[model samples]
Target: MRAAGIPQGTLAAGQERSAGIEAPRGMEEDSGRVKISDIRVKHIDRELDPPFDAAWDPVPRTSFEATLVFVETDTGLTGVGSGDTMAGFAAHAHHFIGEDPLRMVRHVETIESINFHAGRFWPLEVALWDIVGQACGQSVATLFGGTAERLPVYASCGDLKSPDARAESAIALRAEGFRAMKIRIDPRRADEGVAAVRAVRDAVGSDLDIMVDLNQAWRPAGDITRSIDVPAARLIAERLLELDVLWLEEPLKGDDRQGLVDLRRSTGMRVAGGEMAQTFADSLALLQADAYDVYQSDVVLAAGMHRSRQLAELARMRNRSFTPHTWSNGIGLLANLHVAAGVGAGPYLEYPYDPPGWTPERRDFMLAEPLRIDGDGCLPVPQAPGLGIVLDPELR
Candidate 1:
């Protein structure tokens, strides 16, 4: 379960693995004084051979794209983050070029401001935290409070499949050490989706915790099609209720506060969503309205690590689960992972995996090698300085 920066020795549960690891060699004694020297962006694309047919997306995804953000310090320390495209960021890159890399609060605020006028470049904040962890000689998880060193992860399957196929996959994932798995259900194919869940339930019974994703939270770019209406979602949800699913994700629109409440109450299930809320206020509105039992806001996509910690804590205060949606690349997963482990985010984190089309190899194409889940189906937080992102040297 160890990644690049994990120590060689065995670590007791919840122990901080980066306790004594120093900053990289040649780094200054006073790494705290390091200033941001440069911020470089790298675009890497891996053409998918089989083409991923995710249930949420109509078109078969033929390739995977990763946008890598590197934050270099004057002290020769370079922390990396990968997530959304840094479009229009270069025009405003100078805002952070010469500033202190450890000024995480300031950088997060700046990125949010730029997000209003440019893009949601929260990965920059992730890069900054990576630098801050390195400067202080600690992993980001330790800096985020080190509540726990590991968190249970669920296999997040993307593609839509037949009942038998999905059931077979579920059994295999359970055998491979995954304690839970999330199955995506297309809004258009509601009946078949419920059938898939039933099949999985019949196959694994209580051996696996099942989660269902309706993917009605928000539509992707250029997707004009409206999501399923409330009645339709409720209909499908009623069917899934029989299978004893752990949680039902994105069963309604992000802004449909009343509808979400109705669904949760009517179905008597743990409703989850808020991953792609248009803004922070939107998530607050949903939370304030008591729309969800579980908050799946992604650290990278929804908000940077700092703000996401706020959301997770707030959700915890309300007795709501805070396992986030980590559909982005491996770095994005790590960013979310640190915060989840740091805050003791419950029950299960998302680990995207669907063989032949989507796998760890494609999700973590930026890393030198893919990160492996532990034997117990838990994802151990990286113990390395910074995010511990070791990019492939050949990726120019």
Candidate 2:
């Protein structure tokens, strides 16, 4: 069976490219199409000089790891993407070998089934979309629908700092062109987190829109700890409301749809979650229940580009927001960007950054140039063909 939102036909036909731009030479056969020749995965590891104290992690991240996927066509054109470990995918590689890369709808169906029985291989979908964009001589965002040229960015800080330190950091971000910032609230240290939010609000006043993340959806590996009860979460929501928070993200578990709805209704604050819902079906449930004011799902992690486009549109039709959670490497983030920008979803998109720990340079070490917000604090959607990815030449 086919998943919802994916169109019925294939991208192999009725294709169009940007004006004046041309697809690579000799990329088509008698069929006027190219077949997937190979799918390769590379594991990249980079060590952090000063370990990163990620709010969600039980311990500091000493090194950064990325799984880069390369999908090559018979025409010698290759598309790249990065995300999950792609473990157990080697056994499933035969699924896409020697098939038309343009049969994206079919490929998306196959991958969705594999995801239920095997592991997540959506990055391959990202790579295939990358190939389709290059074949069309347009950016994937354009292929997805070219809705907006750029989107505003929010500094998604991952580390926890003292109230004073965090307030100082907020000031720095405001000075450096950040119009908004997200502070991760530790469930265990709810009071401390509230204090930090209060401090930042006092420091920045109304210049920057502040978002708070509860990080309660999924726990770190080996974390058997229980999530905060609804009563506790509700109390925290009340506290954050006074601080003028833009949104309270993941204040409850991903499955707590009713709790999320109730919290949003009671507290009157925008609730955002579902970043890792694992499927379009799961997210649809949340959207249907009116559980959140803003829906966030990483395209690479949960909904592939096709499904994400549909999800974003559905959210808009429902008068809800669709800003995705983009905390992965640059490629993964770009995947989210193309889909989000293509569908015009958001008042702000997540841009992971926290100085001296997680920076654009470290998050995008695989790219030739790290993506940064411009002087106006907008993340420009790459107009170049494909996802506009440029791998670092020195990165072997």
* TM-scores of the models, in the order given: 0.90, 0.91
Candidate 2 error regions (>4 Å)? 1-30
**Tens-digit lDDT track of model 1 for 142-239:** 98889888888999999888999999999989988999999988878888888999999999999999999988877877887777777898888778
Tell me the tens digit of each residue's lDDT in model 2 across 1-396.
333544556234556334453434443344666989899999998999889989888889899999999998999889998887788899999989988898887789999989999877889999999999999899998887788888899999999999999999999999999999999989789999999999999999999999999988777669977778678888998899999999999988888888888888888988899898888899899999998888898888887778888888899999999989998899999999998888888889999999978999999999999998999988998888899899998753
lDDT, residue 169, candidate 1 = 96
The TM-score, computed over Cα atoms with residue i paired to residue i, of candidate 1 is 0.90
In candidate 1, the residue pairs with backbone N, CA or C atoms under 3 Å apart (3 or more residues apart, or in different chains) clash, namely: none
Best by lDDT: 2
* TM-score between candidate 2 and the true structure: 0.91
Alpha-carbon local distance difference test for all models: 0.85, 0.88
Tell me how far the alpha carbon of residue 365 in candidate 2 is from the true structure, in angstroms, after superposition.
Answer: 0.6
Q: Any runs in candidate 1 off by more than 4 Å, and if so which?
A: 1-32
lDDT for 49 in candidate 1 is 82
